[model samples]
Target: MDHQIQRGTVVLATPWGVAAIFSGVGSQYAGMATRLHQRYAIVRETFTEASDVLGFDVAELCTEPSARERLNLQTESQLALLTTSVAMHRAFERQTAGPAVTHAAGHSLGEYSALCVAGALPFAAALRLVRHRGEAIADVAARLDGGMMWVIGLDTGTVEHLCRLWTEQDVHPVHLSIVDAPRRAAVSGRTADLHSAAGEFEARGAQVFPLRVTGPFHSPLMGPAADQLADFLTGIDLAPPRLPVISGVDARPHPGGPAGARLLADQLVSPVRWHAVQQRLAAEGVGASLEMGPGRVLTFLSAGTRGHPRPWPVDRYEDFDALARAMRLGADDEPAVLDACLRIAVSTPTRRQDTDVAGHYRRLEETRRARKPGAVATGLGALDALLAAKGISARERRGHLAAATGGRTWQ
Candidate 1:
């Protein structure tokens, strides 16, 4: 574990490989997204765009240590985590020339963030949805007096047994909320139940670490919140995903549309198939994946997962080049550059457009603008500085630009 925490360079294979991206709650703190903000225009722009939707200075909140700490408050924490994950991905996409990843998934609140990034869900609307979700979860936890604990060094079967024993004890029963690895599981229930189970779990030589979370999330205890979330999403519009996104619930390619919404809603009361999702990604041909967010949690879980060569943590500017090297950039490797890190899904006939047609059309217009020539103009700000060193002929530049953007104007 100590060695895993240390910094080092990665040795990459010649052909490069596909990557899967995942992020979840926890591992958030003060100034989590500030590093990318300092170095990448995409990160800065992402926060700014979210800020407009949220009606608060999200960028300021994330970069300011004091405010960032307070951001851990229920609803604030969920939004902050999502914003940071999106910022990291956008920064990563801006620097890379082609598809960086072929698959993606987000755990719990992270799934909503994934949906927003995948273009299946709009950024502003996702924020509104998750904000409501976070609040509902917090409310349920308050009403039910919920709590959670992490039991390490125990398989899922053993953890389930322990949970059953406690639930039978009839003092605030807990259930598996997250199964992250072969020996890692989180049991959630009432606060007292979690506290009582600690001794027995530890007595059996397992490491019991209670979470500083607000609810027994992803367990049956979250049934109320799940129902509320389901109803809340009924009026929202969702589109088909462009690139495939794995579901945290079933560990399969999410069937985008209303069905996807149900899966997300059920995630509130179901154990997140964390370990299974990674294995599934490997099974599906992703040779590698990057923890494109504030922490190395997912990267740590990738160890020993089949077909996955281990993931890299792209949490800082230094990580960019290392990830680039891993992707075999500039090698004989074809740029399988992922489409936009976050793109709207293809129109689905089953999708019900939001009632606000004007706003919906405006968002559609933005999507169209994004596909036009030089749409990524702002993201290329850094590289623009380097172009001054040499002058290529207008004709040659136009030809190259035409090839890349389907004959669209360069500027």
Candidate 2:
């Protein structure tokens, strides 16, 4: 393929590149550099008590070292992560020309960033929430001594089965916290339990790595944190979202209803269905995805699902010219066709509700109908073949289709 041709499909093809910019946190770092004069205002202003307890300077954790260094401390790490992602989203708005953010979703603390992006909460309020969250985790980490770990190349089923066996063998019952893919899952619990689980997984042909989190997040152990955070979040005034935001706990699209913020607080103690988030986005026809922050973590999380073109890692590059080249899309060309296809698939009906699948089919049929006779024959023939693959009889539909094609018979 020509480097300029981009490596993917147009509408029904895999997305070649993301048009919209999804970002958070990095902008905050830039703003903090000028605004705070290296004071670390967000953490110092919000997490006063937690900062006092940790003895380490929260400001230094957030602004003194590099962005990657801030990520080392769970509290500062998550806060900076959320703030930076929000900043990136803003930067994207300044840079891109498109509809407002269609929908948003974040992993763990990134949920706050999503909400901020959607305008459900203010920047300062979100910072406070993160501060409290960090304090709660730091408190728990100090007392209970727990941590989080990532396991690669194992499906949830296998991980759950292994965890059960580990529990039977006197190891703690670690909870599956984040399911990023069919093969990648993160678990959380006491450090000892995690260590023992790592040993057991290593024995079973799996790789386990520890995360830089202070507490056993998204587990029963975090119940106390959730309860406290719930009180704080619920008491605050959280406006409805201006844009769509996905729920990390359920992998469902949150409608910015009354319960949105409450659910966010509850997320602290619930498993993050990250796998579902990416799958749902792909299913819904998101052609191109952009990972906003420093690392390619979200894009990495989305690797297994179909529809989305490989996610574009956007950083360092000042503009999207490189990305557009990579995706093989021109400024004038409609966004990738695969993105449209994904939208069609995702918007398609389900047993619980009527999806727009019929609409998609109608649109495709119309486009084929409008094509030249020769082209219609080829397209209908392809549709017939696809129907056959699904064991559906297209004979009856084929006749009507042939008549519509003006005797341009396929076969």
Candidate 3:
């Protein structure tokens, strides 16, 4: 399929009961979507097109270590994440067979990818839009001394009360950036206010960790970015989304076009109701959801949300197997549908809440690479290649294979 074709996500529904989810910025890592780029012509062309629009090589940016690290910065992460997600979605569409996605949702930056999937925004336009937003956000961060902190072990009510308390105490503009799960939230503000709030929460037996970010994203502190973003969007005319896309601002499905633009713009400074979005999708009977891009964050979040829709992650090109399984299971087959339902009903499908995700996973990935090497050396694990090339023995050599399995490491 050409990039010029009228696309997916136009309020469209797949015969299968599924939702397409997108991963956000924090999910960025080196070598993201590399497998897709190497195996699928569409994925490679997607990055090539994005590279042209961004005036740099997006595919190389994802593959290169230093560039990928730069992508973690607010200015770069959003674009990289969006490009990878859109590329993956586009490639999936061209596949011979797969499950249909009835709904789509994205976390913060991921929403742009969802819109692209919805066909509301062209891929190039989406890339340009995210780049502009990132630049605006980076500009705001450059001028303002701000940061974000994750407050754990605290209820939404308590977090809200704390925000109110800080405001009352003259902390200026401290605000909740995201309600990640039931008791987990990310608060954004000036450095002092963020630390102040963290200290307060910690004193009350809550755990707080500073997010690896340069800006106070999703808070009133982003007003300047919002302004710049609105001006940047002045010339763009977004088409109506063919598929239903959820808005992080209010956790509601947006009906594309001007309304979608408004919702995206508002999300710049509004708290991302990610947990609520998960709940809404679950309530809508989205049997299973797939995180389209690298990182299992959304998959893990599924375990924390209100209902277990059985999130299958698609962090790598190999992760498409899970996507295929989702489509096949929900293929209107009574037995397969019942099997999935029973699996979800019987399993909690999540980890303990207090895991040191950032540190632990980084180390875990490093160790796995050291021990296993080959495709596992990169986050995209190609077991077939590993088997094809000397079967994971002392030395290694290989060619890229076609598969869609997603895991921080090989599943």
Of the candidates shown, which would achieve the greatest TM-score relative to the real structure?
A: 3
Give the alpha-carbon lDDT of every model. Answer: 0.65, 0.57, 0.67
lDDT value, candidate 3, whole model: 0.67
Please identify model 1 stretches exceeding 4 Å from their true place: 1-17, 26-32, 161-172, 304-309, 316-319, 326-411
Provide the RMSD of all predictions against the true structure, rounded to 1 decimal.
16.7, 10.5, 15.3
lDDT of 3 by residue, 314-348 (tens): 66335465556543421123233223222322232
How high is the lDDT of residue 124 in model 3?
90
The Cα error of candidate 3 at residue 375, in Å, is 40
Compute each candidate's TM-score over C-alphas.
0.72, 0.65, 0.74
Using lDDT as the yardstick, the better of models 1 and 2 is: 1
For model 3, the run of ten residues with the poorest summed lDDT = 399-408
